[model samples]
Target: MFSRLIRAALLAATPLSVSAAPVPANDAQRGLAALQAMDARVAAVGERLAVRGAPLCGDRQMRSGLLVHGLAQYAPAARADAAALFGLGDAPAVLAVVPGSGADRAGLQAGDAIIAVEGDDVATATAPQGAARFDAVQRVEDRIEAGLADGALSLTIRRDGRERAVRVTGDEGCASRFQMIPATRLNASAGPYVSVTSAIVEFVASDDELALVLAHELSHNILKHGARLDRQGTSRGLLRAFGKNPGRIRATEDEADRMALYLMARAGYDIAVAPAFWDRFGRRTGFGMFSDRTHSGRRDRMALAVREIALIRAQQARGEAPTPDFAGR
Candidate 1:
């Protein structure tokens, strides 16, 4: 979340050249540290979920288990400061490498700059002239995805100012990418990407609670709710809250909630935390009440989680695999 403290820090920490002055203990430095810490936590949790929930995802893909960020992701006003402090370049660079992941096994390290993917020159891509530009990063990701789809994926990484080829035979995992956005909103969303704001990450009490959030978003993607809503002719604007659209949206949310518990259980997280976390989130954020017209109320969501948890626990007790109940399944 972009807190007042962080915003104030960002303002105080204006962009400067690398040769300007020795890096001081400023708000920018502190903010960068905080952001990197969040990145690490999100990458670790996301990698675990991707691996553990792969069976549920059904259609697995080759995943490198790397979290990347570039200078372009920073505000234009803060890019120089960020680059000076973090040694980040315009090319997509590794921010975190999941432990025991393909990237880790391939000897990839944080700060490694990816110049090319599968022999394609990704570094040559034009750098966008603004803050929060992800075109370059997404280009590299597209290349990697295309390469992996064909067969093995290879990367040319620049580390210690030396470029070398790294052959990456990635692990099979869910197709979705996990991302942590810098925002003040305590919210998350899913389509091809499962994104959680820094606010929600900070709000979660523990990894178990965080798993509840991630699993829910992951379920939405696995269920293809966004695409399904389009197929159902659901509106994306204010009309979404009117007529039958709210019911249709709420149906998907309910399905995702139910599927989320199973995902948590499959990932070996404590399913018992689901109900309490949703209740607390609902009360604290008013997320399921008042202005929220497309979601079940706090009470209904909590009740559904409780019921699903019971089923999951029963299956666990009987030495059976916990699974979600799809329609007619």
Candidate 2:
């Protein structure tokens, strides 16, 4: 009797695994159908708005390349990669570099277009598909992995349409998983690291907007919001475990916004555009519209971001040395 009682208690104490029961096909289908419906609605709205040349909120799309360029050490090469991957190779651009990684230490800057890699002509390569860019990057990585024990590689880059060659030495101590992400979604905290999502770069906008986005994300890393989140997790315990407490989540976002504003201003970007970008997509409304999971309500978050930008501008005007744009420097 006692053994049976103990078994019951143990069972009661065990948490239910989310995967224990597989999601039903019907449920999955319903979710997909809902998404398709939303997509159709958005498309209709877009069609109507296209006539006006801009949506009600202006353009909801955030230009992310500017942010990536501001954060990257080798801006030219990164821009080339982004352009190549996004089928904009003919356009001048740069891609993002992982923070504290080899690229960061080698003085590689964002906004630098990679004209060549290790003397190989990169400009001739075909535009990359979603995974092709990764494959191309891996090929270079494989070369390093194969025999470049010296941890050095040569890169030919173009900055503001001027070509130059620079040598980058790898650092194993640097974290490998860090990514350059846009500032718009710079709120998600993933343990010791913060998560950033990129915006699709549109042809109509200048790259400066993209740089601002990157600057904002880099600020989040500089401020060390991830560590704070971890501490909050420990303190809150079960509340966090059950997702009942949103305090830490909200705090991290607020801190990131504040930090991003400082970083953008310091990077020599126009602060006015930061608010302008949000103003374009700040207020989006429609029922059965895009699910809340993919995007935050732009207006509410933009308001917070604007406040932070104002404070940062005030600080900069006071002559406080601006924060460095690069991470791990």
Residue-level lDDT tens digits of model 2 in 1-329: 00001000000000012222112245433332233222222222222222221111111221111111111111333433323222235322233333343555555554465666567766533343332223343333333333234556676777656888877665332111123223223222222122223322221144445544444443434455456666555333334423523555455445555555544454455656765665564432332111322223456557766776666667678886544233222
In model 1, which regions exceed 4 Å deviation? 1-25, 126-128, 287-290
lDDT of 1 by residue, 1-329 (tens): 11111111121111112242225467877677676666667777777887788888866788877766667656777777766665666677776677677777888877677888877776745253654566556566677777877546799999889999998777777788776777777888776667777788899998888888888888877887778889999985668778888898888889988988887887788888877887888899774333647888888999999998888889999998887767711
Give lDDT: candidate 1, residue 103. 78
**RMSD in order of candidates:** 5.5, 18.6
Evaluated against the true structure, the overall lDDT of model 1 is 0.72
Predict model 2's lDDT versus the native: 0.37
